[model samples]
Target: MEGVIDGDTRALLSEDGALDWCVTEFVRVVDARLPPRVFLRHCPELATAGSAGPITPSATPVTLQLLGSDPRGLAANAEQAISQGVTRLDLNFGCPAKTVNRHDGGASLLRTPERVYTVVGAVAEVSQRHGVSVNAKLRLGFDDKQLALACAQAAEAGGAEELVVHARTRREGYRPPAHWEWIARIRAGVRVPVVANGDIWSLEDYWKARTLSGCRDVMLGRGMLADPWLARRIRHWLETGGERLSPTPWSARSDMLIRYADAKRDAGMAEKVIVSLLKQWLNIMRGRDSEAAARFTALRRETALAPFVAGLSDLGSSSDSTSSGTAAHASSTLAG
Candidate 1:
């Protein structure tokens, strides 16, 4: 979610009232302490009076996420984020990127529960001093699934207000069939609330995951990427105990894409970057829509920003016919 779940994506997801809160892309913590501008740069929501970002027609609160190995450096950075009006902070211990693991950050920490405890403890101390909530997101383990309980206990011992477990080891690396049973084990072991994550792409998946993991709360990542209204649908189901709503039409999604583009433009991103991001989203959508595949194939080669935008505009006009069909297809596939 590093490059994918940027400010624009958060704003786009917020449009449907699906997200209760969002965590920003991890701010890398190195040898030196980063300035407040660094946090704001990653999460522009800090500049908003309510510490929320413009999510189309609404605003959603955002939590700042930080990644690092050093206990003190992360703690110091947490202090900086809070000073800038960040109310919630999340520690990243679940990232599986090779580059991040090589640097002794992210899921690599799973091998050393002592270090995890130290890091989380330091940040929690700082957060407590300022009355801010500190949470941790972690995978089951590094390469050993058995170590998951120890890691969860470490996080709880270190004072993590809540723990989010992405039910796979670092070695699994987004493979199908996330091990949600581990989340149930972690929940039983930890005193803090446990939120389950991974491979929840549809309402059926959500129900299965909730039952398997024994978790009422979930954190949607890729599922939200594929379906923006996922959270709204889940919320509705929880409230009314009725059948899940049908997926939003692809035509409606085109409007969201346009809004996302406008958000990036408003944030001063270059047109090329915006185009690249759009293609990235479309590629993810291609998993569910043949029309998206065709559209991405056509627009992937366009280099100029204006032409790319115009092409999207043209595609948006004709998306209605395929919208419902595409949504049904995605839902059936995911549910299956």
Candidate 2:
């Protein structure tokens, strides 16, 4: 994803010239006592993205993200990460993956405000000591809004410089009516910068959220994935109030697929891994083209990236990309 986002994907996305900050994949905080080099490996972009060659400017200058549950462990990891030139430390308390939640990372922390307090406090202390900044990403709550305000309060009390709150409770998943109203309440309750997240899949949603939350800073995760230009559009709307965002051209998308496949190959991923990655993106792309949707279904039945790319090339060549796809089309399959 680094090479794709920083290479050809960025190239195609920036053609219209818009987009701001980006965050890398979650660098799992696996061991409490791992070496700094391991952290560096996960955050190699601390140097720059697409360094292999033909460096395209990263879609948004990316911030290295870290995920874990242990306060002391996360603190130690943050210390090493900052020492290695990481500019910002984003604690992931909003990931809804079952594996992560099972381990008490991500959204599970919403079940326990005390734990959130401890973890945020530890990371913020380390960040302050090292002259770095710490931020928290969180969901409403595991079951309801009972713990939502408490979690924000804990994060703020623990020294978080900002909070990114996904509107829905962990149980709510994603449905219509994103509950941006809740984000507004969280903004009112928290003194630090509160970013409105969740359900922001269109320019209208972004504007409505900004108006509702009264917070200028917003986080676009799935929204950006579904439409890479979403952030730039949001930035444009924030500045000029109405930016037209067209979908990626089929020809451009085809070129992007080839480049992504090549980057995956260069990165040494297996053919299956490469295909799987492409499939992930196509889950959203499919909504724009019935042929693409059918091809993705067919590609899933195959075992090689070559066939997948060939299929996409064929489909892309035959169809025209439109701007009327679903708002969630870009991120339909890729979860974060």
Candidate 3:
């Protein structure tokens, strides 16, 4: 979600005011405190003065996330983030990227619950003094489920106010069947609230994840990218007693893509770079929307920003930017 979920994406998804909060991509901390520019780059919202900390335009809170292995370095950086008005912080211990693991950050530390305590304790100590809350994002364990409970308890003992568990182990990567039942185990074993994450792509997935994990809230990552309206969809269903909204029309999706392109261009980003970003987002969307898939196929070879956006905006390419009876699959295609 690092490259995928940026400030613009957070703004668009949160604008509907359905999501409780949004989190920035992880700020990779190492053995020393990073500069303010680095923190601001990862979370531009921090520079905005409105609430206790960074919040989206709609006032949805934005929690700054940090990822690192060293306690002292992480704590110093945590202090820097607090100085920048970040009231809520999330420690990322669940990233399964090979590069992250090779560097001894993220889920690599899950092998030792003690290490989890040491790092979390360091940041928590800094946050508590500023009246800030610290949260932990975790996978079940490094290579297995053996230490899931120990890790959860260690985080709580180290002062994490809440834990969001991406049910699979580090070994599982982004594979399917997220073993949500494992989250149930972790939830029952921890004192703090546990948030279920991974594989929650639709309203049905949301209900199933909640039912299986007994968590009151769940986190959205790629799911939000695939279907920008996922949070709103779930909220609508819950508020209406199982009533389902019509599938998000293709025009809505295209409008978002075009708006994203315009935003990057306005920021002075190169045409090539903006095109690449749009392609990345469209690729994720293709998995859930047929119109997006067709547009991606037609525009993938394109290099210019204007033409690529035109391809996304064009609704006459046989697919016609219409659901055409694929709405059911887009909304609830996966089977348990």
Strongest candidate by TM-score: 3
Give the CA lDDT, 0 to 100, for residue 266 in model 3.
Answer: 92
Q: If scored against the real structure, what TM-score would every candidate get?
A: 0.90, 0.83, 0.94
lDDT, candidate 3, 143-194, per-residue tens: 9999999999999999999999998999999999898888999888888989
- Going through the candidates in the order shown, the clash numbers are 0, 2, 0
| Cα lDDT of model 2 by residue, 250-286, tens digit | 6555566677788769878798877876777767667
Candidates, ranked, TM-score = 3, 1, 2
Evaluated against the true structure, the overall lDDT of model 1 is: 0.78
Per-residue accuracy of model 1 over 1-336 as CA lDDT, tens digit each: 657787667766775555667778899997578987798778876777354422223555677889999999998888888888888889999999999999999999999899899999999999999888889999999997978999889988998998888989999999988999889998988889888899887788888988999997888887776777677777776766565676566665566777788878887988888888888887777676665666778888987777776666674434445322111111111100
- Angstrom error of the Cα, residue 24, model 2: value is 2.3
After superposition, candidate 2 runs with Cα above 4 Å error: 1-17, 48-56, 237-243, 287-292, 315-336
